[model samples]
Target: MTVTIRDASLADLSVIASIYADAVLTGTASYEIVAPDETEMKKRFQSVTSQGYPYIAAVDESGDVLGYAYASAFRTRPAYRWLVEDSIYLAPAARGKGIGRLLLAELVARCEALGFRQMVAVIGGASPASIAVHQACGFRMVGTLTGTGFKLGQWLDTVFMQIALGDGNASEPDPESYPGTLFAG
Candidate 1:
């Protein structure tokens, strides 16, 4: 099945919400116990897009959303303006087909183009699939937070992985003029 990656639109919010809902309800990728409704998801979509961050969807030729990904402020502080946290979710049928890798690559390229210097992945449950995929994309294991989350009748770990974007702190950060600051403002 051919998949196309594109900027997510308001019309895609329902499918995006559905994909995330499945992950929240059944997978360890998301720590949220309750699935967020479409309204809440729409708000989140707007929050990211309005800030000039990329929120993307992977869809089949038929226009079905197979997965989605986005970059958001790693932290709200101004000093963290050049850093972004990435989140990805895929439908059950889309797993293990390299779609995650495709979506993540596009996210990295978009973030780099936006002048973000670092990208982080906070993988819930230290999922092997997620870790492997991140590793394949050049993210190194930063650390894992043990027992940081309680879900599905067990304590879960959150794995942290990171990758450097364009120029990644090799030079001093000029937050005042960086494109990444658009989100900080």
Candidate 2:
């Protein structure tokens, strides 16, 4: 089946919220089992687009949000502007059908369009599928923070994966010197 990838708007937050909450409550895909409600989800969606980061959704016919991806600051410090962290989530039945791959590929493209120089993916240790997905998307394993994330009465380890897209010969840009404004509280 061919899925169309498009920029997610504020109107699409409900379905994106459901997908995220589904992963949080019923799946080990994310370590956080505390699923957020629609209000919180709306804020998350708003934050992504408001900051000029692409919040993309994969939709089947009839515009159902089967999955989504977005990027956010890798670190708050001025040095990290070119570095962004990524998130991809798919509906349960949509798994293993190239939905994740499509969203991730689109995410990298969008981030690059926004002048991002690198991407970092933080995956729960239990999600080898996610790890493999990012690896297949050109991310390399960097390190692991053992027993760092706690959820569902258990501590989960986090694996860090990174991809560098910057021109290797260029000097690092000072994040604060950039004229772009970022949405932050």
Candidate 3:
């Protein structure tokens, strides 16, 4: 099965929402309980695209969405302008293939091209695949928040993994800009 990665469109929102909702509702991939609708996802896609970020999907030649990945503002502040947070989700039946990797590779390329200097993957500890994949892609586990999330009637851990896309290590962030303020409310 050949998997192709490409830019996601508004029409792909339903499939994306289905895959995301499946991951959220059934699997331990995400911690949210209320599954978002297509309308909500479409708005999300639009927001990301409008901001020049990447929202990519892996699909078969027949145009079926196998999985999706995206990079969004890590923090809204101008000081955090170089940073982004990412997410990847695959269709229930589409796991175990390299689809997630393909989707993320595209997102990384676009994020870097957009001049993003850092990318973070804040992942659920239950998804070892996510952790391993990000590691293979060069993201390091920077922090772990034990019991930061509650899901499936149990406390869930959140892991913070990150990679630097640019050269210098920024020790001092600009104080005037509040982090995570870039996304329009």
Candidate 4:
């Protein structure tokens, strides 16, 4: 399957919502107990894109969305402006086909190009597959919070993996050129 990664559009939200809903319903990647509807997804999409964050989708040759990924502020505070967090979700058929890796790589490149210095992956449930994909994209295991989440009738751990983008912390960010709307006062 030829998969292309591109900026997500409003038309893609339906499929994106489906993909995320499935993940929330059946997988531990997302902690939400109830899958959100398309309206809610639209609000989230607007929130991310409005802030100039990179929200992307992986589409098949026929123009079907197979998966999606995006980078959002790790925290809304001004002090964390240079840091962003990544989230990725794939359709059931898209798993294990390296789609996650592709989405993550593209997301990383886009974030770096935008001048983000650090990208963090907060892997809910500490999913092995998620961890491996992040590792393949040059993220390193930072720490794991055991029993941090409870779902599916059991306790789950949350893993933290991080990668340096651009110059990372080796040099200071140019205060004159903050990336995106994240630095808006």
Q: Which candidate number maximizes lDDT?
A: 4
**Candidate 3, lDDT over the whole model:** 0.81
Evaluation by lDDT, superior candidate among 1 and 4: 4
Model 3 Cα RMSD, 1 decimal: 3.6
Tens digits of lDDT, candidate 2, 1-185: 77999988878888888889989987665777688988998888777667777788999988888899988887777667788899999988899988898899889887776677888998875578898889889989999888877776777788899887655226765444332357233
lDDT of 3 at 177: 32
Q: lDDT of each model, Cα atoms only?
A: 0.91, 0.80, 0.81, 0.95
Task: Return the top candidate by TM-score.
Answer: 4
Clashing pairs in 1: none
lDDT of candidate 1 over 53-155, digit per residue (tens): 8999999999999999999998987778889999999999999999999999999999998778999999999999999989989999999999999999889
Q: Give residue 165's lDDT in candidate 3 (0 to 100).
A: 69
Q: Please, what are the lDDT tens digits per residue for candidate 3 over residues 1-185?
A: 98889888888888999999998888777877889989888888888777867888899989999999988887777657778899999997888887777777778777766667789998985478998888878888899888888888888888898888644256543344322335435
The TM-score values for the models, in the order shown, are 0.96, 0.89, 0.89, 0.98
Screening candidate 3 with a backbone cut-off below 3 angstroms (N, C-alpha, C), the clashing residue pairs are 75-180, 76-180, 76-181, 76-182, 77-178, 77-180, 77-181
lDDT of 2: 0.80
In model 2, which range of ten residues has the least summed lDDT? 176-185
Query: Worst 10-residue stretch by lDDT in candidate 1?
Result: 176-185
